[model samples]
Target chain A: MTRYLLRRVWYMLITLFIIATFSFFLMKILPGSPLNAEDKLSEEQKEIILEKYGLNDPIPVQYAKYLGGLVKGDLGVSFKFDNTPVTAILFDRIGPSALLGFQALVVGSILGIFLGLMASIFRNSPIDFSSTIIAVIGTSIPSFVFAGLLQYVFAVKLGWFPVALWGEFEHTILPTIALAIHPMATAARFTRTEMVEVLHSNYIITARAKGVSESGIILKHGLRNALIPLITVLGPMAVGLMTGSMVIEQIFAIPGIGEQFVTSVMVNDYPTIMGTTLLFAFGFIVIILIIDLLYGLIDPRIRLAGGK
Target chain B: MSKLLEVKDLKVSFNTYNGEVHAVRGVTFDLNKGETLAIVGESGSGKSVTSNAIMRLLPEPHGFIKEGQILLEGVDLAKKTSKEMQKIRGKDISMVFQDPMSSLNPTMKIGNQIMEGLIKHQNMNKQEARKTALELLTLVGIPRPDVRINQYPHQFSGGMRQRVVVAIALACNPKILIADEPTTALDVTIQAQILELMKSIQQKTDSAIIFITHDLGVVANVADRVAVMYAGKIVEIGTVDDIFYNPKHPYTWGLIGSMPTLDSTDEELFAIPGSPPNMLTPPVGDAFAPRNQFALEIDTVMEPPMFKVSDTHYAATWLLHEDAPKIEPPAAVKHRMQGFAQTGTKGGGKR
Candidate 1:
């Protein structure tokens, strides 16, 4: 297992390398020079600015320097943000984004699994019908629209919450819901389908024949098997939650990595853009690896014999 | 012999989209204490359904016992509430299913799976249950029970998993054990071992067993009384010797004739003609009439009542009527019966 994990980590590093190389060069290839806004200054001043940021160097030389700095754990300085190290900026913003993402995931997963189990247990009943309706509504409405509507009703109309900010736990309510709604719906739908399928499995009939209670058959047998498929979805869902949160963060004026990343892109802040994009890619890859490891633990067939 | 379980005119049906499907029609039988009764039938012959109905384990919204009295030790089991039935299941009765691998939960340790009943029904604590689980595993012939008990179902071989399932069924020491095709999924060698194990276990526990299967070989080895189900009802029921030699039902004759014997050099084994009737719109009269070559004219218009063949044997066939012509069994079946008699394996109908 250790060897297998080591192989996976090596593969992940190679993937990261490809992503970093592409994003770095892709940013360079985009129209509009980083020094375009320097028209307000003299040509000599512009040249000085270009020299300071190493823009005058050839692309390959700059790429080599960037790669060296990356190896040394130096992400250089943000061009638009008063020359602060891109890593520092990222660290500052990541806390809120991580907290928000974590909150969304925990809340979404708990509710999804609960409603999914309920939907399966009371299949073809009002509970299932209502859950399907809620999932449809949750998935159909855009996160930004939901965020805007939630802010208007809960914050502006009724004055129950602060409209836009990320100061306290309370401030995260609307944006987190906006970010979580769709993925929560998707997870719930998947869980319901998988649980229903597991409940109908031949093993469940055997369990029942063994005189196991209905609840015992479901909680102990059905849920564990159903969780395998649900676990696979969690990896991509986490990435989607973080990436999808950019819009919600912008709407709520939250100081999160998603917000910072978006701002960096509009102004072409090279260091910030590279750092955040790399961070996103890293987060996605690492979560997927953890999910793969979890699969081996949950299922003995997979653990004894590695994934086929 | 004292009765262990009795079913009176048990009828089970499924409400399908098209109409009601009579899965088990007027099936009735009795299991004696400490005796193995085999319910022999083809698939969908209502053998499994009858067993499931007795346990009240049938899937709802589709399967239901329409009319019946499943009496266990004089108590009508069909009348018991779900909660009341729960008390009886795994405590007074236990069942081992066909597929051993699927019978045990994949995620659970073998010890935990065995101990679940001990903890739930026997009221034993975790430590006590674990110790008993290990002992049960050892009794079932699992090697290194201490270490193996911690292992999950996937770690064990197919034969070993069947042993684990047996160990679980024996955990509660149920008075009545139902093994539905327990050896059907196993190879011949493993099947023999399991049959021997069940026989020995029965001797030790003295529990009545309802062994449901389609294998006559298995029935011959393990069954004391045989109940042959064709459609949803018992076509013939008698002592094992009577079923093999003096069988009265045509379905039983077909079943016995279909068996491949070591001495026989026939090109192809005899197969009963025509498929089983569709249960959706079940036949108006005898369900097996279409497939029985010896079926009389009355067999097509009316269902036959169980006619007494002996003090302990009975068969449902128009041919068994007193006025009906006496017909002889096929030469092959008669030859096998004569061989069986020559071997002196036929004991009088007394245990």
Candidate 2:
């Protein structure tokens, strides 16, 4: 197991390196420069600014410099954020994004799983029908649309919370709901499909024949088996949630990594854009690793297979 | 022996999108303590449905006991609520299914699967259940109970898994163990071992077994009494010797004739022509009439009642009628019967 994990970590490093290289080169190919917005500055002044930041260095020299900084765990300074260190700015913006993401994920997963379980247990009933309807609507509609509707209903008309601006708990509510719906739907849909299949399996019949209580059968045998596939879908969904939703952050005026990413791209802030992309890639790879480990824990077949 | 279970005119049906499928139409039988009664039939013959109905494990919202009584120790199990059945299942009645590959839960350890019933029905504490589970593993001939108990179902081979399945079914020492083609998924050698294990276990516990299988060879090996199902009804039922030696119903004759015997020199084996009738619109009168080569004219118009051949034998066929003309069984079937009589040995009945 230790060897397997160490090998996976090694592969992860290669994957991250490939991603870092691609994103860096992809930014260089974009049409505009970081100084495009500085129209009021004279040509000579712009050159001085470029020289100071070493932007006049040839592509290979600049690339070499970037790699040097990366090896030392430095993400360089943001081009447009008052020259702030990219890491410090990222650390600052990450709090609200992580908080909102975590809240949405926890709430969404719990509600979605509950909905799915109910649908499967009471199959073909009104509850099942309604749960299906909820899943369809949840997945079909975009998060931003839900954000707009939530703001209109709760903030504009009902006055249940503030309209926008991030401050109190109430301010966090609408955006979280918006971001939560998609995952909730995805989880519900996946859980229902997997559970429905599992509940009808021969083992379930064996469980019933063993005179296991209905609840016991559903929770222990049914849910445990169903969870394997659910985790597959939920793992990627979780990474997407954890990184923050850009449109949602913008609409809610929440100072999050997603909004910072958008602003960085608009101003051609290379370091901040690279930092955010790398953060998302890192989260995705780690989540995939965690998912692999979780599979071994949940299913012994996989666990033993990996041993050899 | 005292009667352990009595299934009287038990009818089962499933509601499908096309229509209601009358899977089991008025089947009746009784099982005595310490005996294995094998219900033998081809696919869609309703033998499995009858066993599932007894345990109240039929698929819900569709498959159900349409009518009749499943009397377990004089108490009607057919009338028991789902909640009530929960207490009776795994404790009083347990079942081993056809496919051992899928019968045991993959996520669970062999020990926990065995312990589940003990912990639930017998109310055994964790430690006690664990001990009993180990004993069950040992009883089923699985080596190293200590290590095997902690292992999951996938670790075990097909035969080993079936043994684990048997261990789980036997955990609570159920009075009635319904083995629904338990050896169907096993190889011939492993099938014999599982049969032996079950027989030895029955001897120790005195649990009555309702063994359901389509294999006559298996029936002869394990069943004291055999009930031959055709469509949704039992067309012939008697001691194992009676079904094999003096099968009266044409369907039963067809079944025996189809099996390949060890010494048979025939160019081709006999196969019952045509498939079973669709349950969506079950044919009138005898369901097996179309397929029975020796089917009488009355068989198509009127269903034959179970005529008593002896105190322990009965058959549902017009051929047994006093007024009907005497017609002997086919030459091949007759030869097989005589072969068994002289040798005092059973045919392999290999498909």
Candidate 3:
């Protein structure tokens, strides 16, 4: 297992390196300047600024310098953020996004599995139909749209909570719900389809023949098998939620990495853009690795394969 | 032997999009302690439905027992609530399903799969159940029980997996073990081994078994008695000797004739002509009439009642009627009948 993890981590490093290199060059190729101080500063002043940040060097030289800095764990400084280290800025923004994303994931998976399980148990009934409708609405409509409606109904009309801000537990609920709907819906649909099939599988009949209580058969035998497919989707879903919360964060005024990522991209903050992109890529890869590891833990068949 | 299970006029049906599918229509049989009663038929002959109904494991809101009673030691099991049946299922009556590849839960450890019933119905603690599970694996002839117990179902071969399934069903030492085509999905050689295992296990446990299969070869090997079903009903039931020798029903004759004995030189194997009637619009009289070559005029108009051939034999056919012509079985069928003694002796000697 340790060997497997070490190999995966090695692959992760190689992947991050490729992504870092690609994004750096991609940013350099874009038709814009990071320091767009046209007409505002004298040529000497602009030259000084450019030279200070080493942007005046040849593209290959700059690329070599960036790689040198990356190897030393330095992501350079954000040009638009008054020389703040890209890493520090990202670290500051990640906490809120991480908390919100984690909350959304936990809430979504639990509620989704519960709803899906109920829908499957009482299949062809109103509950099943309603969950299907819920899944459709959750996936079809955007989170920002849901965010606006929630703000209108609960915050503006009802005066139940703050309209837009990130501070206490109360403020987290609205954004979390908005971000959670898609994952919750995805998990629900997958869980329902998989659980329905698992419940009808030959093993479940074997369980019933073994005198397992109805709930026991459904929970222990049916749900465990159903969860394998659900877990497969969870990796991409989680990363999507974390990175996809940019619009939601903007609407709610939540200071998260997603909003920073958007701003950094718009202003051509070279270090910030590359840093955030690398971070998202790193997160996605890590999540996928974790999900792969989780598969081994849940299923012994995979565990043996992973062991070798 | 004392009677263990009795089914009287049991009818099962499934609700589908098209209409109600009368899967099992008025099937009745009785099982004695320490005996294996084989229910034989082609696909969709209601054999499996009958077994599932006995276990009360039929798919709900669709397939269900529509009528009659399932008596276990004189208690009406057909009337038992699902909750009540749950208690009786693994403790008193357990089932071994076909398709070992799919029967065992793929995600579970073999030991835990066997131990589940021991823990649930027998109320054994984890340690005791574990020990019992190991013993069951060993009993079913699984080598290295200690190691194999921790392994998942996918690690085992199909025959080994079926042994694990048998272990799970035998965990509580159920009085009535319903094996639903248990060897149907196995290799021919593996099928023999599994049958041998089941018989050995049965001799040790003395559990009455309801063996459902379409293989006459398997029937001759394992069964004490045979019940042949057609469409959704049992058309003939008798001692293994009676059905293989003095078989009265044309369907039974077809079934026996269809099987190729060791010395049969025939190139084209016999097949019972015509397909079974669709249950959605089941015919008015005999469901097998269209398929039976010996079918009489009255067979198309009215169903034949179970006519007693001897104390231990009964067949549902108009040929057994007093006024009906005494027609002989087909030449191929009579050939199989003549060769039954050799196969029967071989099967008994092997056991």
Candidate 4:
């Protein structure tokens, strides 16, 4: 197990290196200049600005410098946000996005599992049909569209909640729902498929033959086996929720790293963009690692089969 | 002997997109107390279906007992609700299936699986059920019962898993234990061990066992009476001696002839000529007529009713009619039958 984990971590490091290198070059090649804006500096002033942010330096030298700063835990300073250090800005706003994303994940998984189970149990019934339709809608529509529709209904029309901005628990609702919609739908559909397959499995038939009640057979045997597939999606779903919250956060006017990320990208704030991208990538990599470990824990067969 | 279980006119069918597939058609049998009745058939012969129908464990939305009366000690199980059936299932009647590796839950500990029925039906507390489960593991001849109890199903070998299944089945001391191809998935050595364990356990519990399998070799050792099924119906049923030595049905003769005996000199074993009839639109007459070598003209035209060969023997075949020709069995089968009869007593095989 230790060897397996060490190997996985090594692979993660290599993956991170590749991601960092690709993003660095890709961002450099993007059309707009980080310093040059429609309403801003003249040519010489832009040259000075570019020099300050290492944009005037060769791409290799700048990448090395970026890597050096990254090693020192200093993500440099943002050019678009009055020269604020990227780390300081991100640290301040990360709490709301993390909280919103976390809530979304928990809510989505629980509700998705419930709906999926209901759909499987009452398969071919109206509940299953409607749940399937809802899942389809949730997955098909983009998060931004769902967020806009939710804002219109709950905030603009219903007047039940605030239009935007995070304050208390109530402020967390819309953003979380927006973030949760796709994952919840995905989890439900996956759970339904996995559960249906498990319910028809020979083991479940044996359990039923053993005189186990229908509910007992489903909960104890069916769900336990179904968890393997369900756990596989949790890693990507979590990362998606965290990074994908950008548009939803912007829509709700919430102060989250996702919103910071979108603005940084728009104005070509190099330091903030690099910092946020690295953070999102790091978060995703770590979550996937943890999920892989969890796979071994939940199903011993995976562990016994010797981790893939 | 008082009848412990009686299955009357049991019919099971599956509703598919094409139509209703009649899996088990008008099958009937009776089990007395402390008896071992083996239902023998090839694959897809409805042996398992008849057993599942009695337990009401057939998969829904596709399979259902179209017509049947499964009476346990004179109580009609068909009329019972699901809840009522649950009450009777583990406590009164239990079943062990083929492929113990798949039967036992991979995630659950063997002890927990055994104790589940004990606690649910026997009203035993956790501590008591745990103790009883350990005792059962030991009873099923599993070595190191104490250490083995905490281990999951995957930790045990195939044979050990079957023992665990047996332990769970016997947890509530059920009056009837239905073992559906229990040894089919195991190796030869493990098969012998499991069959021996079942026979020993049956002696201790005095329970009627409904053993379903395709192997006549297994029936020779474990069964008291044998029911030979073809298609969806029992074509022959009799005491082990009657079926083996004085076999009357053509299907029975084919089955016995097909079996590879240790002393046989033939290079190739005999096999029944054709595949089983399609259940989608089953034949109006005898289902096995197309496959029977000794088939008569009436065999294709009309379904034959079961004819009593003796007080303990019965077979369904047009050849068993009073005016039918006295046809002799194959030479090899006759020699084997003669050998078996000379060596064995009235009750030679153990349950």
- How far does residue B251 in candidate 2 sit from its true spot (Å)? 1.0
Candidate order by DockQ, decreasing, is 2, 3, 1, 4
Give per-model TM-scores: 0.96, 0.98, 0.98, 0.95
Identify the leading candidate in terms of lDDT: 3
Interface RMSD of candidate 3? 0.8
Over 4 Å off, model 2: A304-308, B346-351
The sequence of per-residue lDDT tens digits that candidate 4 reaches over residues B166-285 is: 998899999999999999999998998999899999999999999999988889888999999998999999999899889998888888878776667654566789899999999978
Better of 1 and 3 by lDDT: 3
Best by DockQ: 2
Reference-based TM-score, model 1:
0.96
TM-score of 4: 0.95
Off by over 4 Å in 1: A1-8, A304-308, B342-351
* lDDT of model 1 at position A214: 83
Candidate 3 docking quality: incorrect, acceptable, medium or high: high
Question: What tens digits encode model 3's per-residue C-alpha lDDT throughout B258-295?
Answer: 88766766545578888888998789888888888888
Interface DockQ of each model: 0.63, 0.90, 0.87, 0.60
lDDT of 2: 0.90
RMSD of 2: 1.6
